[model samples]
Target: MMSRRQIALAAFISPLLLSTSASFGADIYPSRPIKIIVPIAAGGANDATARALALDLQKKLGVPVIIDNRPGGNFVIGTGAAASAPPDGYTLGWALSAALSLNPLLYDSLPYKPNDVEYIAAISKSYQVIAVPGNAKANTLKEWIAEVKKSDGPAAIGVSSFGGTVHLMAEDLGDRAGFRVEPVVFRGEAPASVDLAAGQLPAMSGILANLLEYHRVGRVKILAISSESRLPLIPDVPTFIELGYPISAVYWNGVFAPKGTPKSIVARLSEAIREIVETPEFRARLAAIPDVNYINGSSDVMKALVKADQDYYGRIITKRKISLKN
Candidate 1:
């Protein structure tokens, strides 16, 4: 119904109009539910943190936020799934230290690389502690090291997972103290804490939260914490640094999106998370989880933290020649 010149102009304008519409669509992110893939089993500390964040994020974004637990493969399964997802900002991930730093250092190949997912914002960090059975002879970390040195064989230490902060720190401790550590991998820290409490396990390093109750009741003796200084909850428990060990088992959990996610969306989400984490209500909720501290780190901060972890753990893994593949 139009002239040739008019038809040509109409075609040119249609593409621009569609492009503008697409941009508008992106601006209204979370028009639907946003799913955050948590790379750990439900009911764990990471899962709890993810759920807490999701609930607040849902409220802030005016949309439903869901958590998808895709546990196993040392976070590869869920993290790979997140990496392969469409970069539309609807699908994201809750990533921990192993996914971002430790896995790459330990594995020769992975379904997802460090660059596969973009770090959005860091949510929280959990600290670890070295503990032994309540009735163990060694009371101090130095005494424990001495006892291990006297052992005829490798000392058995329970670890929640391989290629994790706990495993590497325990290995580093043994490496420095001139003893071999036999890491008995458990499904999670809960079961390992149970064994340690029952004296079925000789010693173990676990998150301070998992061991706090046990330590309080005398089921386990927390030798040292990974914090820079003593925690108010357990002020008497000294830090590894205080004991002359350069090991720290602190690990962070953060939000991550696919690599190609739009920068605007990344910034928006990061800002929202930082705002939520700084709230008094959120801080109170976080405090309920022992040993967990709210960091509220932005994307740049997360990148730096990830890099620092990679550099620190890389040296330890390379020096020890540790391979999770084995």
Candidate 2:
């Protein structure tokens, strides 16, 4: 028995109420500044990439992004911290290939499972290189291998951590080339690089981008890069494939939120990360870095990449019995 005006008013307010509720729900996301936990120590490749992406994301999302360094346990410490955080958009972690893909195989017990986080986007992919001190007599990988074989004792290879990607790479090199690699562990790559430059360690394996400054300054000499093709910046430096030892793996940097975060918030974060990676300036900067490639993909693609890498490395670790327990 209500009047036509009343019926029309009710109809109008119904949609308005629904719209307001949706807006309120969306507004609940990112209520404050976001925290990005970096598993590695400050000044390493992961930290540097995370800080760079955080800068771009802050500009795009209009929210402050803080980096929390939790360096320990081969990424278990910080990744565990991130996994245990509230399933809100405020807490995230910089997911790297070593942690998300290789750690499960390397360690028997992990605090968190790979499925414990929602993948966002990959920031970049880096190719690794083998480097020696600038004054080293060996000018090429062949010469370096010959020199190592000639040494009376095992040739020392510096790595940031045991069971890391670099360790596996060095192991693979030794196995294929029939040389003995004595791993010299350090807290992180910066120290390893410093020791290598000082001639305390004969050589080290690291991301090309991290070693570029030293290479430019003639502090370290890159013997070979582990990539499918030569990097444009250093075309003179031959790839492992060219030297008759083709072993290539891609190390990527990504972002993730704790599991059970809202789909809407995940979408928002994924979109923001995509925007940051797609920016021309970011693309150019990544390209300029030696042997680095920018990868921009959806959340699903990132998840698939993680899964693929996990399976790939799991097989290698199992077959080789590469356990961190030792």
> Which candidate leads the pack in TM-score?
1
Candidate that would win on lDDT: 1
Could you estimate the TM-score for every candidate?
A: 0.97, 0.86
Q: How many clashes in each structure?
A: 0, 0
Model 2 pairs in collision: none
lDDT of 2 by residue, 165-280 (tens): 77777777777788867789988788888888887778998778767788888888988888898887777788888888857767888889899988889899998889888888
Off by over 4 Å in 1: 1-6
Candidate 1 lDDT score relative to the true structure: 0.89
Clashing pairs in 1: none
Each model's C-alpha lDDT? Answer: 0.89, 0.82
Give the TM-score comparing model 2 with the true structure, all chains together. 0.86
Report the lDDT of model 1 for residue 108.
83
Per-residue lDDT value at 285 in model 2: 64
lDDT of 1 by residue, 1-326 (tens): 89999999999999999999999998898699999998899997778889899989999999999999999998889988998899989999887887888898888888888788878999999888889999999999999988988879997999999778898888888787788878899999999999999999999978988999999999999999888888898998999999988877688999999999999999889889999999998888888888789999988888888898898778778887888772
